[model samples]
Target: MSSAVSNQARPAEAGPARQPVPGPASTGTGTSGAGASGPGPGGRGPATDYSGYPLVGSKHPWRWVGTAAVALGVAAVAWSLATNPRWEWGVVAQWFTAQSVVNGLLETLKLTAISGILGFVLGFILALMRLSASPLLVSVSWTFSWIFRSTPLLVQMLLWYNLGYLYEKISLGIPFTDVRFFEVQTTTLISQFAAAVLGLTLNQAAYSAEIIRGGILSVDQGQLEAAAALGIPAWRRSTRIVLPQAMRAILPTAFNEIIGLVKGTSIVYVLAYSELFYTVQVIYNRTQQVLPLLLVATLWYVVITSVLSVFQYYIERHYSKGAVRTLPLTPLQKARKFFATHAVAPSRARSPR
Candidate 1:
């Protein structure tokens, strides 16, 4: 009787016509059909659900614009080369690979290196002057810095070249009187090369002084206080704690300035110094092929600059040791890993959860 009652409560089995069937509508398609096409009881089936706007990830109008700009630049370069008459590779190669050009390049490099070292040394003293408590010392340094920085490098070079015209001789004399102890002949005291070196060094010192000053100022005030609290001498504190940190801060800028000075030595050609540019001018004047000679100078500059760039990188890495991370991989290793990961990823079915 209980089994019959249960069967009666369950209701008679429905025929196919009365039974509901799962359809595409039940899967959120929202289409109406009897079989899989019909919506289920949930009423949320896939339908002509074009009621919402289409999804696009973020749009970048500027990216398209930049791409167009780069395309135009490349086109312009190609057009210019085709139209211009300056594309003689033979002359360029000959002059570029000349022995004279090589010598000039070496000389240019040496001058830049020597002048830069001397300038940095002098600049250190000037930086100290600017930081000194003594008003006189500070004023003197400020004046020197202003004069050199205010003047153009070309003007300074010219002035040094013609220094003999201003003074017959500069004598070591007592102040306010012509009580001369020793005299330096103006002509002998300043040669073209000497003047070039002097001008470059002095101008560089002014700029480098500011670089150093900025570095020193970047040191934390609390660090200085701590050093004082520890009873460290003022000089010792500066040299030991402050200067080392300042050097690290200033190294990158100093390296850039050094590179600039290397290129800037070309300006010495105005004085007829037989530096790289002047030598190139002499050769090209004789050869009468200006473009080729210029190209030679440029190539030499590029080569020397490349070498110096490596040195600068090493120096920067040395100073940046504690500040920045060294990469885990060498460039080649990193590139290899990158390609391998992308090209040989594990198959999805083989991948572990």
Candidate 2:
């Protein structure tokens, strides 16, 4: 009777057992749940959906309209130029490759080559002098650059051409010395071509000196210090380390100057040196085909400048290797990529049913 009463009391004290809580993954609601269709580990959400869907691109109506407008404008200009007889396209073709024109072109190239070399060399020396520790050297360099840059190039050329009037003879000798050195007539020495070269080189050197100096200054001070610490000779440090790096800054401006120099050769026409422009002027004078001759000169200048620009682009690309992680695509590569991206494959023709 006591044991039966104890069992009844224990049954009355006991409560109902608890159920286990459902996890997010099991319930299909959290990151790992069945309903989650993403790109997460268990296909969590819409991100992981690989079902086929048609690709759609954004519309750019304005871009198409602008391109069409440009095309129409270009077409209209081309039509006008083609129909205009005043342009004398026939005459342009006639004299485009004439012997006189070819000779003039050669003269222009010769002037450009010689003047460019001399100008850059003198400019480099002036730049070094300007940057030197010696006050005398720096002052002299500064004064030379200042005077040449301040004066008009045309005036300088004219002055050089007429140098004989101011000084009948040029002599190389010690001042106040009875000892004689060779003396030459100023007029004989300062010919039209010589005057042109002197004027162009002096003027170009002034500008180029500043450009080179700016380039040199662009190099980091630490580079110079590091080279010095390494016990590298001054000349070696300058040529091998500093200048190679500085060229990255210098080449663009230098090439612009060169292009300008090519055209600046025309200024020598004032001295009666028969460069391309002078040749063109002479032809137009004889034929009275002024516009056509002028056009020929313009076209040749354009071609020469274009070639230099292309050369500049490649040179700039070469120097840019260390500055950019990846080089830019060449024109040909860019064109290929553009066509590949825009090309559409033709749809297959359906067979007759």
Candidate 3:
């Protein structure tokens, strides 16, 4: 009787703790009362878990929208290609192999190679002069650069075409004296091709000077300071430490300018030079296959440009030492890499146990 009375007294004493848990008949929020939690008072409140809730986090709605837009654009282009009635694959194939077009391509390659080399050489010299400390050198370089840069390239080419009129003869003499040692008529001294080369090269030099200056400036000043601290000669510092790095930075832009120069060379048609464009103009004027000949010029440009692009890639890779962490692949190289990867992937997949 004593033990039973003790157990009954214990239950009454613990009633406050038991009140915290919701009874089977209760219907309420997880809290049992104003201050009590749901599971027995301190025995972990009704396990108020959020793990059962749906998971949500940051999502890129714009990325999905962009993907959809790209897909739609591709589909539209495909539809246009599929439905176009004027598409003539056969004619295009025939025109692509025409002899005139083939000859034009060869001529374009020659012209581009020659002009690019000459322009780069001349431009490099101008760039050095422009950066010289002497005010006289700077002024001379500035004046030359400004004259060429300010004047339209087309105007320059035309002026070269008619340069003979400006000077009947160039006399080698002392300044402010007619004491001529040797003289030659301008026409005898310079051919049309030579004149075109001079005009194009000078114009290209001006632009290249600016490009080179930007590259030189892009190199960190700390490099020059460090070279000086090491007691390196100024010329050695510039040639070895500075210029090599600057060239790497400027090569891509320089390559682009070279490509532009290649196209610009077509403007020499004004002088009736038998370059690729002149060839096309002559063919079209005679044959009147305007669109086809124009296509011929376009094809020639594409082939020559494509070849130069590959050359540019190799040149860029050569210069990109120490600075570039990883060199990027050319389009052809990337395609080759992809195919090589795919070829090995299947073998790797099959060899596994």
Candidate 4:
């Protein structure tokens, strides 16, 4: 220790500082070896080697801060929801699976299914008509969309329900002929259910026709022309080449319309048709539990939309093939990755220093 102090005190006595020390490569370790700090050919000192040191990760304090802020906000909202008495969550639970409510839910689902299927079918035809070269077909398709889209859905429902006033009877027969296949009073034909279906179907069709047409139009014309050059049948080109690609564009919007139709089904209450919303109205009217009943309907709608959203995500993912290099991870895969990363990070932090 006295000698080291003397060396520091008399630095001028030492000659010019030696060049940077050689690394482990220059100093042999196996045969007649010199250690990491041992001298090289010219007796050079060992240079520092960073490779032996433990790695340190970057820090992002703001990231943690933002995460904490969002977590606190979410927790506050959840707390409020749990503590609030006016939400009447118990009442929501009570009527949520109630027989009448369930029955009404079934009716809503039934209406949505029947109307959605028929609406898309009719819309497909209308889309074809709109896309066709014939002027009459185009005119008719455009007129149908315009008429339905221009008027309020409520008016349409009301008008359809009261059809008996304008048309005494609805008949299926050869036009300009006496021969009739079927005939019935308009009131008998357009019952509550029938009117509701008709209104929903026509309104849905009007929107869906545009959606399908837009999707079809989005497909490149160059591909269709090239397909024809290969002598593929027109029908085959449309179905195999065109429809598949068009579906990628169509499915998202189509599902949106279907979800909209689910909510729109509530509008049938105007006809006094007992769908979920109408049933909720009836219950609340009798019990004077308006907010709770509305909450029930809102929660049911949330559940339905949530389910539909999951379907939309997967369907969109399926069609995304070839469009993206790698498919996005599923919810389960993301959860696994998150846990794996954070779990390892904590274990590493707690490791022996």
Top candidate on TM-score is: 2
- Candidate 3 lDDT score relative to the true structure: 0.73
lDDT of 1 at 345: 60
Cα lDDT, all candidates: 0.78, 0.85, 0.73, 0.86
- Per-candidate RMSD, Å: 13.3, 17.3, 13.6, 10.6
Q: State TM-scores per candidate.
A: 0.71, 0.80, 0.71, 0.78
Backbone clashes for every candidate come to 11, 5, 0, 0
Over 137-204, each residue of candidate 4 has an lDDT whose tens digit, in order, gives 99999999999999999999999999999999999999999999999999998999999999999999
Error of 4 at 130 (Å): 0.7
Better of 3 and 4 by TM-score: 4
- Report the lDDT tens digits of candidate 2 across residue range 224-300: 99999999999999998899889999999999999999999999999999999999999999999999999999999
Clashing pairs in 2: 36-44, 37-44, 37-45, 38-44, 38-45
User: How much is 194 displaced in model 3, in angstroms?
Assistant: 1.4
- Ranking of models by lDDT: 4, 2, 1, 3
Q: Order the candidates by TM-score, highest first.
A: 2, 4, 1, 3
Q: Candidate 2: lDDT of 329? A: 98
